[model samples]
Target: EAGVAQSPRYKIIEKRQSVAFWCNPISGHATLYWYQQILGQGPKLLIQFQNNGVVDDSQLPKDRFSAERLKGVDSTLKIQPAKLEDSAVYLCASSRGQGNINEQFFGPGTRLTVL
Candidate 1:
């Protein structure tokens, strides 16, 4: 089985600039999630999607962050007017379903640096 794929392994941008990250999950996975991991901290879930519909986005900063899994296969996360505090590794993960015991596969994150 193939793993998830993300683009632009690293990025640097000035404060208030905009950036976007792309993700391609494993084929057949029905649940996708985006997470933010700061240095020295655990990953925090930003949004969850089941198919093309959003399941949870309460932790996502709507004012700056937005994400979508348009075809239930690929996803994109964008941050406009990014702040310094938004610097982190954006991780994309996927699972077979919404079941409790599903194992998640994560991609190499896109690391963002805000200057």
Candidate 2:
């Protein structure tokens, strides 16, 4: 089976600019997640999607960040007017189902830098 896949493994943008990242989860996975990881911190869950519907997004910054999992297969995350503090590695992960019983497979991640 293939693992998660993410595009633009690296991105650099000026502050207040816009950037977008894409993710393709495992073929049979039904649960997908997006996470942000700072240089020295663990990954923080930004959003979660079960099929085509959002499951969680309380941590996502609505003012500048948005994501979608259309068709319940591939997903995209966009950050408009990016901030310096937003620079981090964006991770895409997927699992067979919800809950801790399932193991999540992760993509390499896209590293973002805001200048």
Candidate 3:
């Protein structure tokens, strides 16, 4: 099976500009997630999708961050008016099933640097 894939691997943006990152999860995985990892901190869940339905977005910064999982497969995360503090890695992962999945495949991530 294919592993999760994410791109640009790195990004540099201004504090008020907009940027987006893309993800392609492993085929046949039933659950997908987007997470934000700040320097020296664990990754925090940003959004989750079970197929085409959102399972969680509780930690996402609604004012600037948004995401979508269309067709329950590929997904995208976007930040508008990006903040200086948004300079962190945006990680994408996926598992074969729902809750209690023992493991998830992770992508290399898009590391954003807000200038």
Question: Each prediction's Cα RMSD?
Answer: 0.6, 0.5, 0.9
Q: Who is ahead in lDDT, 1 or 2?
A: 2
Model 1 clashes, total count: 0
Model 3, which residues run further than 4 Å from truth?
A: none
Candidate 2 lDDT, 1-115, residue by residue in tens: 8889999999999999999999999998999999999999999999999999999999999999999999999999999989999999999999999999999899999999999
Cα lDDT over the full model 2: 0.98
- Give per-residue CA lDDT, model 1, range 10-112, as digits (tens): 9999999999999999999999999999999999999999999999999999999999888889999999999999999999999999978999999999999
Expressed as tens digits, the lDDT of each residue in 2-114 for candidate 3 is: 78999879999999999999999999888999999999999999999999889999889999998998788899999998999999999999998886844888999999999
- After aligning candidate 1 to the native by TM-score, how far in Å is the CA of 46 from where it should be? 0.2
lDDT values for all models: 0.96, 0.98, 0.92
Residue runs of model 2 more than 4 Å from their true location after superposition: none
Q: Which residue pairs clash in candidate 1? A: none
Model 2, residue 23: C-alpha shift (Å): 0.3
Ranking by TM-score: 2, 1, 3
> What would you estimate as the lDDT of candidate 1?
0.96
> Which residue pairs in model 2 clash with each other?
none
